[model samples]
Target: MSPYKGNRKINIPISIFVVVFAFILLVIPTSGNTEQLITLDKQKLPHKFSIAAPEIRPLVYIDKQGNIAGQFITMFEHFSEQTGIKVDIKVMPWGRAVQQAKSGNSDAIMPALYTNERAAFFAYPSEPLVIFSGSVVLQHRQDTRKIDSWHDIHDSQIVKVRSMNLGENVGRLFVNNRNELVEVVRIVDGLQMLQHKRVDYVVMDALIASSLIEELKLQDEIKVIVHPEESRLSNSYLAFSTSFAAQFDVEKIMALINQYNDPDKYIKQLEIYSH
Candidate 1:
């Protein structure tokens, strides 16, 4: 013990040196290392962006051929190419797609109108995808209600597709009047009701109304009138869920959206598919 006690003092410094050397070896990535620290760093980054949208025609929908097709699809494809970020777009029922975004089960939802309620669950860019207005659809000869303003229809029977967020775009009063408001499952049903004289008018987005009229061949039966000047124009956005926002650089994505959000470009794209 006496002989080894002298060596123990020297061994203390050696042990310290060994610990420091081992730590350096563990931290410093080597060219021959398969599990390189740089590789781990790369794994921490996101590879692709996911988006969800409703089956709304001419905007985003599944065509008769069972493929996702629309202006929004083309826009996202361009975005993917511009940013080098892969995009996975899924088309589903409007209500289900919105619910999934609200619950953060999906990365993003497109063609969303901005609202304080929605802002709670999603992060919207200042740039808008499209600027549009809503219109009141009436039967050709059955309904003769004059909508000089939004309130003009307060006393008339008004129907809209269920789960449509028109109230946020128009106002609470647009959908809050129990006496006049009726919710239906589809825009086609609302138009049918108006055509059959069951409802006086149907409120819907102008672009959507145009598309549906052409699709259902109801142009002869239904007429669309834009909301009065007092009504504010609504802007649609490609909104990301809050959880997805936390994972990606939302500001960069928004910057890219602003760069490409040209009114003329979108109008041309829509016109290409318009009947």
Candidate 2:
């Protein structure tokens, strides 16, 4: 119980405490040196939705450069600028592309024409992106058949890519009238089929058909029929992956469409791509 002995015991405990503190200091990071790591899930992962042009109509999907068209690039740029979101673009054949969206393979499908039949597999945004028109195409110099009325085309066997609802009304009419329609997997196949007398005619959009004619270098053989106004169509929102529908900025996408879809803007993009 002497003072010196008591002081020595206190000193021993102090030394042990200091040693333990030093060990901890050496092993663990200081507040200044600590770092944080963060990760995101697939849906939260940064990505831009993409859609495809049907294989039957290459021009809608393909460009002069033999890639997806300028329209898509323009669309992406506008949407990105409007929504502050980045997107990845893909152009696939129509049926396959729709299937991709339905299967959760792609985030979205593009330039989709609105039809009740497509509703079961996709999620449509609230805005209409563009209006497109459809027409019938045939050989330029052949004995071209007249389509002054639907009656003229009733008995004629028409060629179209399988699964395209060009004009739902027209389609319903054809179904009601019992018309003969041939389905082809590719637009080129349908064109070739028509050229070789396999079908009486091929139906397609004016822009797309012209693009295909120029693309295939078959200007001498193919031409589009624009009159009689058999069908008028418009595509609303890009079809979303049904599985991923809740993940995207649906309102922002609609806002994007409203902001940049001017006729002048489209023309300027087209002109730039032409060069």
If scored against the real structure, what TM-score would every candidate get?
0.67, 0.63
Candidate 1 is scored at a TM of 0.67
Misplaced by over 4 Å in model 2 are 1-47, 56-67, 77-84, 137-140, 144-147, 166-169, 176-178, 214-220, 231-233, 263-275
Indicate which candidate wins on lDDT. Answer: 1
Model 2, TM vs. native:
0.63
Query: How many backbone clashes does every candidate have?
Result: 0, 4
**1-275 per-residue lDDT for model 2 (tens digits):** 65574335334667888899999999986654242111113224333565554543432455557865566566667667655456766766667878888888887777676677777887787776555555544543463665545445566677777656656545743676466777776677888887677777777655556666776776666555544553444454567777777775655555555676642222111101111
Question: Looking at model 2, which ten-residue stretch has the lowest summed lDDT?
Answer: 266-275
Q: What lDDT would candidate 1 get against the real structure? A: 0.66
Q: What is the lDDT of residue 162 in candidate 2?
A: 69
